[model samples]
Target: MDKIVQFVQKSEHNATAVAIFGAIGVAVVALKALSFLKVLVDVFLRSGINLKKYGAGRGGWA
Candidate 1:
């Protein structure tokens, strides 16, 4: 645990390491967002109906 903390502190003191870490963090977040979008697309495709058309239909609890 101490070694991990020391490594983090050392990295924080370096500008290049900080920039690399920031870029890696951004990439991870972007990948997760893209995965969520893919799942949503798959769900939409399986439902076989357009969201706009479904929303316009009369149904309970509108």
Candidate 2:
């Protein structure tokens, strides 16, 4: 759409605003993924079983 293109052009011209918006977008996605992971961990913990048995291996990093 013309309006969408215009908006993108406008945003591109404003470096600070673009950076702020990009940071906000990344933060929102990170928070959502973390929340989902938390829920998954809670569910697995409640099941009283080791997730490793399901072929999930431990990472080398601490």
Q: List runs of model 2 lying over 4 Å from the truth.
A: 1-13, 46-62
Candidate 1 lDDT tens digits, 1-62: 87756676785566567678899999999999999999998988666656556565556245
What C-alpha lDDT does candidate 1 achieve relative to the native structure? 0.77
Using TM-score as the measure, the top candidate is 2
Cα deviation at 50, candidate 1, in Å, is 18
TM-score of decoy 1 = 0.52
Query: What's the true lDDT of residue 14 in model 1?
Result: 67
Query: Clashes in model 1: which pairs?
Result: none
Report the number of clashing residue pairs per model: 0, 0
lDDT of 2 by residue, 1-62 (tens): 87755676776666567678899999999999999999999988766778776666765333
